[model samples]
Target: MSTEISIKDAAKQLNISEQRVRTLCRQGELESRKFGNSWIINAESIDKYGLRTAHMVAEDHPAYNVNEKCKKPIALSFFSGAMGLDLGIEKSGFDVRLACEVDKYCRQTIALNKPDTALLTDINKYSANEVRLAAGLGKDEEIDLIMGGPPCQAFSTAGKRKGLNDERGNVFLKYIDLALELRPKYFVIENVRGLLSCPMEHRPHEKRGDDYPELGLDELKGGALNFIINRLENSGYSYSFNLYNSANFGTPQIRERVIIICSRDGVKPPYLVPTHSEFGSDGLQKWNTVKKAISNLTSHDHLTFPEKRLKYYRMLSAGQNWKNLPIETQKEAMGKSFYSGGGKTGFLRRLGWDKPSPTLVTHPAMPATDLAHPVEDRPLSVQEYKRIQEFPDSWDLAGPIIQQYKQVGNAVPISMGNAVGKLIMNLLKGNEIPSFNNFKYSRYKNTSDKEWKEQFSKQVLKHKESTEQKELGFG
Candidate 1:
């Protein structure tokens, strides 16, 4: 038997769309056979076609001009998982000189794609000068930008919400210190929407009730984000941040993240303009949907649902969840979680082909966050995850199957990254950015940069007032 790979993998390896691969098979440009509802592609045919892999640039390629783009701004990336953000920055014409990551697999993935680029293993171990040297930058060189999404689980609502108390959260502060040390002209920080609401101190689970007594003033209403803003302001940097839904920026997923852009010169950064709208309002294209993103995929390899859960999945249709099943069946499927307070939407959930996918979780088979395919009984395939995250088809994730899912799921959507890149480019070029009025930044509206700053100021003032009162023995 000849060596073979699934059509989805073949598409990824060949750096082409899955539909294009099928077209090649139909035109006898490649050899393939049907396996159930999927296609098995001949690995030998892929090699014979001389298709260039993703991230590999031949010196003779038309896109290759070593000296023409030498003036591109330089960037240093921290917590660069799979380089999704870096890729976006690079696409926007920034030269990513180095990336810092601690995960072995992520480091492998980065090294695989960016062999020449310096990969710093641990942020804590390296000094600012060391990072600069690793990136081949001299001490006198001006670092144009530093960007990354520090670990967000500490602030993620789904997690412990430890804020600055958690060691990972401390790393977030360290990231800020590093940026200050490097004194880059600009810096970018990205995190989950949960960061907006995460309190500086984690409230005890037993005391989480609405009727619980109000906390002291030091425990302000705004979360760690306020502290971050205060630090930046005091450090003489001006910043703007807003929550953004990736769908608004042409990604095929409804993932939301808080993007904070800062400038060392104390000038407020402009907002990122959305290129797509939910209903095609504002003269933008309607948000891309899951169907459009993966309809052409002829093969998939996904995590298997247990036979027990598979039965319920078989009964559900696209856009249907446990709620769509019969009352008796719903109870049977949900078990103890059925009586829980929340919507329990993820239980027995099937994606809607027309809708953008819900945020991709690290695991698709979790009880509370299942991401079952719309019609298929199984979870989304690894290839589908890559597509939804906007990672190039040929980008190789270095890990086991489960680890691959986690890497892709945790990535910032490539489209969102590209949008950030564009914003940075515009700022660098000193171009005036166009504005959108009445823009909905995330699922929640009114999260504009101005509104966020106003809210943050209020919380900071409250904290200061409380501190002064305590000093005067008025506590």
Candidate 2:
């Protein structure tokens, strides 16, 4: 239900006159309803109007500033969306001294929440020395850690799968170059699960078939990661990476990411320790559920689905989706999509009160990836998105409501960040690292560096053998 307040309340909230509020209502600048003659405004409309009409809430502070009093190990952040990962590291005692973000709203978010951290706009415009100085360090001051995930669209399965050939891919290399130049004692890189299989060189689909020649080394799946490993290795950095699900670290979402850790001293930190597990197995806590994540909220502000989609949502219960619809209803609801392949599980789905949410998408109402609330008629709220990502409720998110959702959706789960941060502390402090062997970080196999490399080597050997037999006409 929409929250409504009198015009006087709306005017007071915006610090504008009653006449101006009514003018906005008449102009359709705010959402207003006339009940028996008096105008009542939607409370959310007031907030949105205030945010756009005047200087943003983020304008209260400087865009960037350095903290001279920071005493924790220094971490420099890049591609710092909402500082979700950095927050986790901070929990484990590292100070993120600088944040470099390119997005406008993300910069606003950084300035709003991390006023003390120096903020830079474009990484490409700065040199190693510039980045260091901005972090409040001297020319030769050692960097404790450099952490970021460069844009992953180049390697994302959902995109063109361009790998490092795209312009964004070049930036990915530059981030590593910056790390190598600054020579941080430790660094962390995080990305989507698809990076494991993206090729170093992407070949267009039309160019491949039975008539095409055998795949080149650089064109094979895993080639992209192999090239990254080689580049870091050549730079004298020893790295370890694995696919990990955020839920294992106690995040209330089943989001998986590839985390790569590189050490200047060649000391490898073990994989992240799991704080919870599916079904409470191995004596860990049970996975955090959507019900638990949002149960404390007294009210929710959310976007709504069209009446057509709502018809399907109303038919389904918690944890149910289009699969639960009757046969004819399924066809009507899905239309052409009903006959298309795959589970179509994301269609008209509702979150399960007893289960963790599916991965949070940038847009919660996308047809193929809706993240509806368990019992509500609307999609999950921005407040609920923050909670599931493990961000503190008071952590200010600045921007339009849609942009707020994108920011929260793209953040590294605070639990995942905390895990990485705790591990980094142990490694840097000379404590014995916790080791869990054969742990199912995700549902995939051969994802560890050791196993993945071995498997790739086998593929290369198999290709070579097949080529030799083909040339020799063994058949």
Candidate 3:
């Protein structure tokens, strides 16, 4: 005849330490009765105590809103890898109805943190109506926002740069198709900075002989982006896109990505407001540093450099890379890589505590993209990566160690996601954003939409001119 919860569940529901819960029970501050060594906390007592603890614990926990009514403007996330973007959007007060992801590891992570949210594994298998139903939406109901970053390897400069010709690139196109079908009021598509300059057709390295011919003059320099824009325009949506550095928005890393914001009613998309600046100019705070982000951590597991690389890391100081070593030592350490072109800054690099971390790579041990710790002899740990990406301490990321690294490395920094979410919320509410024309949004300033288009035109024209001459057999 008695309804009660075990002490553990009470602590969990109250968002407090179990010891604190037990102490309260012992003191009779909480309405509970002890059953031998175990405490039988009255269910009513938990409800009463939760109200008081909810306010105090809400700042650091997600369970505080258990009894609150659901907010409006629901979102459906596609390609929701580890839900970093979804987390940011949720923080902005939007309810995420469902998430679609395909990667097994990423799906596990999402399922672990977002147990209540419906998750679909293969997007290709579901129609928009099916997805809506899966999200617990009525067939006639409209989704307020759709957002995701499709797999970006096809457009990544670090990869083969296959653009739309690659199967993954085709999947990017499918996401756009799904967005059109869903008819969301607003949609955001994010991708790598390389997408800004990717050509429509894959251009093989010229040294591979004349097997691959030059592309025609009519080809756009950023073929994939232009195609996406054309498709959205034809579907009666207006959009604006810009390359953003995550550090500009308060994340502690210098990760850059392209975000395209589209509105169904053809309204011009507003730019993301900057919260930090590189040097504290324009009334903004200085960029958060890696030291501030992860320096307080006690010992945790991390990937270590092989002894061969550790030998070189030992000789470097904070902020120094392979280039900082004595010239003879650099040669001795780098061997063949010493003569390689490009900055090669990632080689034997030790991060500086005062500056934002260089963009995180999927694997930190690669010679070309090493992310060795500032004073430690190992790569940044999974915990450090989470902090750098601005993921909450309590957010669970489920996977093996390597998979965890990929999930964190590939995430859109939560701060950047929050900025995007805020812009969408403002648009939804018809709020006029204050202009800060003088503000710098990144270490490299954001390129205006017009400026980007003009630059693209010039690059395409330049390439066309060169290609035409080659067709005429005139150098």
> How does each model score on lDDT?
0.82, 0.85, 0.81
lDDT of 1 by residue, 1-475 (tens): 7999988887887688899888887787778887887778888667545322222221111111224237889888999998888988898888888888887667667756666677777678878888877777778888889999999898887887777889998999999999999999999999988788777777776874445644654345556777888799999999988999999999999999999999988999888889999999999999999999888887776888999999988898998998998999988988888888988887777889998999998899987899998898889998999888889888867666787888888899988989998997898889989999778878885576678767767877776786677678675
Which candidate leads the pack in TM-score? Answer: 2
RMSD of 3: 7.7
Q: What's the CA error at residue 346 for candidate 1, in Å?
A: 1.0
lDDT of 3 by residue, 9-76 (tens): 88888778899999999998688987999899887666545533331121111121322255578898
State the local distance difference test value for candidate 2. Answer: 0.85
Q: Which stretches of candidate 3 lie over 4 Å from their true place?
A: 1-69, 207-214, 217-220, 442-446, 459-475
Model 3 clash count equals: 0
Instruction: Give the worst 10-residue stretch by lDDT in candidate 3.
Output: 55-64
> How does candidate 1 fare on TM-score?
0.82
lDDT per residue (tens digit) for residues 1-475 in model 2: 9999998888788887899988999899889988776789998777656655443343322224555566778888999988999899889899888889888787777776677788887789889988877777888887888899889788788999888888988888888888899999999889988899999899998987657776788888988889999988888889998999999999999998999999999766678889899888777898899989998887666788999999889898999999899999999999999999999888898999998999998889989999998988899999999999999998877777888899889999999999998888888888887677667889889888888999989988988887687678762
Q: What is the lDDT of candidate 3?
A: 0.81
Residue pairs in clash, model 2: none
